[model samples]
Target chain A: MRATFMYGAGDVRVEEVPDPTIVQPTDALVRITLACVCGSDLHPYHSMPTGEEGTPMGHEFIGLVEELGSEVTGLKVGDLVISPFAFSDNTCEFCREGFHTACKHGGWYGAGGVGGAQAEMIRVPQASGTLVPIPGDVDEKLLPSLLALSDVYLTGYHAAHMGNVGPGKTVTVIGDGAVGLSAVLASKQMGADKIILMGRHVDRTGLGRRFGATDVVAERGDEGIAKVLELTGGEGSHVVLEAVGHMPAYEQAYGVVRPGGVISRVGVPQYEDAPVGFGSLFGKNVTLNGGPAPVRAYIEAAIPQVLSGEIDPGRVFDSETTLDDVAEAYRLMDSRTALKVLVRP
Target chain B: MRATFMYGAGDVRVEEVPDPTIVQPTDALVRITLACVCGSDLHPYHSMPTGEEGTPMGHEFIGLVEELGSEVTGLKVGDLVISPFAFSDNTCEFCREGFHTACKHGGWYGAGGVGGAQAEMIRVPQASGTLVPIPGDVDEKLLPSLLALSDVYLTGYHAAHMGNVGPGKTVTVIGDGAVGLSAVLASKQMGADKIILMGRHVDRTGLGRRFGATDVVAERGDEGIAKVLELTGGEGSHVVLEAVGHMPAYEQAYGVVRPGGVISRVGVPQYEDAPVGFGSLFGKNVTLNGGPAPVRAYIEAAIPQVLSGEIDPGRVFDSETTLDDVAEAYRLMDSRTALKVLVRP
Candidate 1:
């Protein structure tokens, strides 16, 4: 089977890798139907530490189950399904509490030298808990949007949910990446009255507007904060969705959130320390939430919307490539030439 | 008038100070009827910066309105009122959002050379917004508890509220100081079924139990976390109230909170930076909320509970002294000889 692997910084290649097989009674073998280059994949693609062994690379995918182990239940061979970025036994305490990312028996794809989603075949542990079955045949046009439920859309939904974004509230989404754009759509779906997208890219911000961003701030840092505050009548937004996980993005979030509001962050943070002491967020009574999205928890609820043609998160996939062009897909996404690149197996 | 002033580290004195007068039309002078040494005061009392000038030191007080400027409405001379730790116009955007501590026109007591609450009289700015009038006060025994509503009780309530404590949830409160003890009580008021108090001091933890701690974990750091996890059947508490503001307290909070739970911190943090990146909380989807209590927002709702004789947070005040003995009060609290010291002028 062919899989994408990063040889080193700024290096990506699609090469033959051993096919995955069900190794545990709870495992299921999935043949990838669709996969994508995620923004987070760029983290290591940009500067993964040198000398690390090349490994299968991808966490989001929609596939058809090819085989299942004895213990797997409610799912059978040839079923169409979506897998969250991480696999979890949904019955764990954390999973039951809606924090499937922290499931006791769960782990991230490709972690610990395991095969990942960017492969033709991958083993999904805890299949019954990790796989969300799609009933009947799914439309080819709906593939990208449904595939988004695996990570980006669910991640964006987590941000809005954590931020408590709801009717009559003003939401400011920072970052113009696919996740940020998805957050704009999710905020709109959550009934936010005013959705503000903070991004400098004209093309991305234009999509943001189409995704229901009522306003756009094309500045970064202090300037962006000023514009958001100005747009919010000098009070700042009631909920600030932090889709970019870096020091600057977090600083802007803290700067633009109204006192007593929440800043929901879903970006895989790049920095180690955040100044969350008395001088920063404490005095304002703001709530800081968001981490890895409990995508499995949201996938079920989000699917109906996509199926009903209520939302088209697939718009984020501006470019499409095949398994052989996985390397090019990464390059295009890294350079921002494409918002998101859909990869077909 | 006499005021408790910190002359240097470990040096506290009650000295003569000029009487307060209304400097603005919005100001109101209050004669301090009750004041208590706060856990936060120990921050400077233990090791104040060298070469810093002496400053009046107290933030919690219930008093009689001694005088009111012409523009001070809804309050009059001789009225009993409780002043929150910070003074705010209570009409600013932040204040309107229930974050009075961040009010544009507000500032903390004893800050910037201003008068503090541990004095015979205090000149409250934005009196209309800063003072909460008590309809009628007769019993002197209830003074300590009512005074607590100004800061400690309100702060505790804020932590519980921010943590989203409710019926059937398990709550773990860090710190056994007055505020922490108050949090145990607050958690109970919020209907937490199990309240665990994490503190090392027998005397303090004893008070915590009286307040509403169903269990006590007499350890700190990792050991404390382990104990809490064990208590909750390895699932961790649903709500972890951070009543201590130091790094270890926060670490314990993050360690003991269940995935998807909240860590509400009310401690005036001693550290500048917290690791809020993926390694810290994002993976667990834990929510970090609470800062300065926004006491003004909570005082109204909490006061009714205290006034109704349903909760006696004043039990935290184990010792009593007069204004002349203010220095002694600090000594006892600093040595942990007193959980809390009530002072009268």
Candidate 2:
């Protein structure tokens, strides 16, 4: 099997790895049909240390069930399915509480001996609870959108959900990355009255506008905060979806959130300390939420939205490649040449 | 009229000051009948820098509307009222959203030239929006509980409300002070299935139990975390009300919160920075919320509860003093000799 691996900083490679077999009665083997590079993967790509044994790279993927686990009752061989980035039993206390990413029996795809999804074939543990099966053969064109449900779209949805985005609320999405754009779309679907996209790239912001951003702020820092404040009549947005996990993004989130509004972050935070004292959240009485998307908890409701043509979250994938060119997929996103890249095996 | 002011850390004095009169068209001169030293007041009592002109000392108070400004239509002379700690127009976007502390025209009482509530006569700005009036003041026995709605009890309610404490949810209240005890009472009123008090003081935790703490842990740091984990089947509490605003209290909040639970802080945060990165909140997917309690928004509902004997939130006031002994009130609360002190003028 060919899997994507990170050798060191800015280096990703498609290398031969042994094929995975169902080791547990609850596990199933999946043949990857579609996988993609994630913004999070760049976290490691930009700074991961060199190693003899490279790190497995991707977490998002859609596939055909190649072999079913004997204990898996909800899925069978040949079914097209989507696997949320984190695999879970989906029956634990956290899972039942709609926090599947925190499920006691769950773990991320690239952790706990689980292979990355950006491979030719991967073994999925807790298959019944982790994989969402599509009834028949999925339309070839629908693969990208279905692949999004596995992580990106749902990750975006989690931001809106966590931020309490709802009817008549104004939302500011800070980032034009795939996840940020998906959040714009998700906010629109959630019936947000207005969405402001804070990103510099006209091209990406254009896509953001199509994703339902009512406005876009090209400036950064105090200027960006000024523009967002202006747009919201100086009160700021009801919710700020912080999709760029940098400190500046977090700062902007607090800078422009209306007092008592929410700042929901899906971007993996690159820093440990943030101001939550009197000068920041405490002074304004704002709420801060968001973490790894409980996409597993959200995927079911999102499936029909994608199927019904209500949202085309796959529009985030601006570039495409084959498994052999997975390294370039990483490069395209890393170099800002692509919003997201779709890789087919 | 005499007023209480802090000359420096631990230096509280009651000095003759000009009697307050209606200064703004929306102001009312409150003949403060009851005022109390709050847990928040201790923040300044401990380390407030010395100054030629000392800072005003109290915020919570109940009084008779001695005089009303021309524009103050909702309150009149001789009317009894309880003023929330912060004065606000209470009709702005934030106030309408039930976050009165962030009202567009709102400001804290001890700020913006408003005299401290611990005085003979204090002028309240935005009177209609800031003071909740009781129809007739008759019972002396219920005065303390009514005084509580001004801040402490409602502040506690804000913690529970912000943390989303509801039926069948387990809650951990992290403080043994007036506000934390109020949180226990508030959590009980909100129907939390189990309430844990993480405080060492026997007398305080005893009050917390009366207020509805099902379990009390005297340990701090890791031992407290272990005990709370054991109490909740190792999943921690669904809601953690952080009534102690120090870093250790904040740390315990994250340490004992269930995955995806809420950590609501109503305490005046003493520090400026905390961890929100992968190591603390992000990995657990926990939600952090709360600021100064929007007591203005909550007082209306609480009035009925106190009036009907549904709750005795006033039990938090363990000490009482007179206007001449205002300095002693601060001393008692500062020295931990009182959970809260009621000062009458």
TM-score of chain B of each: 0.97, 0.98
Candidates' chain A TM-scores? 0.98, 0.98
Question: Which of the numbered candidates is closest to the native, going by highest TM-score?
Answer: 2
Listed models, DockQ each: 0.79, 0.89
lDDT of 2 by residue, A1-345 (tens): 899888899878889889999899999999999999999999998998888878888999998899987799888788888999999999999999999989888888877798998889999999999999876555677779999999898999999999999998999999999899999999999999999999998899999999999999999999999999999999988999999999999999999999999999999999999999988998888899899998988888877777777888998999999999999998899899999999998
Cα lDDT of model 1 by residue, B2-113, tens digit: 9888888888888897898878899999999999999999989878865556888899999999999999899988999999999999898788877888899998888765
Candidate 2: TM-score?
Answer: 0.99
Per-prediction fnat: 0.89, 0.85
Q: What is the fnat of candidate 1?
A: 0.89
**Top lDDT prediction, candidate number:** 2
Q: What C-alpha lDDT does candidate 2 achieve relative to the native structure?
A: 0.91
